[model samples]
Target: MRELTIDWTALHSAFQMNMPEVRCFLSVEDGKVQKLPPGDPNLATVRADPQHFIPIDAIPSRIQYQWLDDFIKALEDSVVRERMEAAINGKGAFRRFKDILLTLPDERRRWFEYRDQKMRERIVEWVREQAIVPLNEAPWSADLPEGSPPYVSAHIDEDSLGNLA
Candidate 1:
């Protein structure tokens, strides 16, 4: 089989959004979240005030949990871990692991951040070893011909994740 290229950003986004029903809100001025001030306008007032509104994308979305570490940590039952570890070592889909993390909101966030950092480190190492330009910060031409291709991209799929495991 050919070595699969990874789109790390998309993978991150996929994992970060583990909470199917919850949406985290962040402060507009700072990237991190901020508490609504006391006596602050209510949701209705905020909706009426353009200054209080910001595009949803402007808010930092949740960071994705990493299957390697986050999934293991989020598991409540040891039997599940054993099965998961076995699956990870062998050929299997990651669906079960994600199912285990779905209900543990706090643990999910914690593990996500932890594993995400490690995932990033792994990406950086791969970049250095391969001498490839990073997708996040690549040196691209400011002035380019129309319809030019992007400078760099690294896409990963389920098959790639299985191989990485």
Candidate 2:
């Protein structure tokens, strides 16, 4: 793939200049048009408040887990290092190893994404953590009323209490 170095701000401004009437409120400012606050809940609010809204294309949305970058780098470094060592031992060509190293970025990204569902898990966790809605607590096994079946009947054990009642 061709490497694209995007000037996000320039692209965004150009987009706005070309299509000034793009009817999206990016955010609200003092109850008017403004940028959306971090972890903003509504896309409609964002579209209406363009001043505060960051265009979708403006941001790099690399969803990665905290340690994924380091972990992937270490893994790739080890692979390249081993290949280099093998080349020094006359098992492979140094140029081949170098090329392999150069091509590792896509591989590393795939590995990171596959290994942990990296960005998705982190984003979901972040959204859940930042959500305004209250999460319902899991029903306690011992608290279930006598007549009620267990919340997870398949997992209930013979000795289990239904709920915390």
Candidate 3:
């Protein structure tokens, strides 16, 4: 079986899609993913070419913007929600949200860290479930310092080799 790999750093940006657009994009039929153009006959009228339909299994990744919903609703009730809705409709949801977050530097930093960690954890779990073995050295490992060689060898007792024979 082939495994899908996702970069965690991209999740926040991907979640910025508007609800209706995201919903329609994620909707599935006949095991195909759709990329419908605006006002296409299928989107406007009806379809026989259901091949473009998004798979139901892939829907969650498409429609996960609730983190933003919580953020804005808590910040300011109706007004903030309206602004965010407008920003989403205008296709600048993430940019507008970040703009609002910028006004509160500490909160913005905390939000970013929290989101990054969440995405990283999720990706790590998926990677483990898929049995992927990462070959490259992790950046923070004590065995490797900046500018050090990636490989190392240590002296061992020669007598140990005789056990193999």
Candidate 4:
């Protein structure tokens, strides 16, 4: 496996970005993530050198919706869970779900923590898939059991959750 000094934060942001108008890539030479808008002159150069620049795909919306559903399922408060279930039923569900979380400071904090943990697990899986052995220690690796894989063991079923829209 090739070892590189990766900017983990930049990589995490690249994975989280889901905008249609932007594209992200990871520079194997420097292990930094690059975001380029359409028509950028440098994009052509990056695309040309496929060996040095690897395209980063954004996490699908279906997977994110599953995260929201799983979080709602784990909540102990039935009232809050019901509100969240309703909030995610139609258009603008992401915004509505966030709005409800904003009113509850503790739940809001918990949501952020949950989301970050899920994203970190995704990042670890992506890194391993790319055959990268990061030279810098990953912040999330500290909690892993000895000899265990660096990823969390949550299953994200895209088709099982159906459409949240």
Query: Which candidate number would show the highest TM-score if scored against the true structure?
Result: 4
Worst lDDT 10-window in candidate 3: 152-161
TM-scores of the candidates in the order shown: 0.31, 0.26, 0.34, 0.80
**1 or 4, which is superior by TM-score?**
4
- Per-residue lDDT tens digits for candidate 1, residues 6-98, read 344443343344444332232222322222333555544544543333212211222222346445644666875666556444333355555
Model 1 segments more than 4 A misplaced: 1-93, 132-165
- Model 2 lDDT, residue 148, Cα: 42
lDDT of 2 at 78: 70
lDDT of each: 0.40, 0.34, 0.40, 0.79
Candidate 4, residue 37: the lDDT equals 98
Clashes of each: 10, 22, 3, 0
CA RMSD per model (angstroms):
14.2, 17.1, 16.1, 6.5
Write candidate 3's Cα lDDT for 1-165 as tens digits: 222323222322233334444323222222122444566666643244333332122224333355555444444347655766665544666777778777767546645544443443343444354343333332222222355433211121222222221
Ten-residue stretch with the least lDDT total in model 2: 24-33
> In terms of TM-score, how similar is model 1 to the real structure?
0.31
Question: Where is model 2 more than 4 Å wrong at Cα?
Answer: 1-68, 73-116, 132-165
Off by over 4 Å in 3: 1-64, 70-90, 132-165
Q: Whose lDDT is greatest here? A: 4
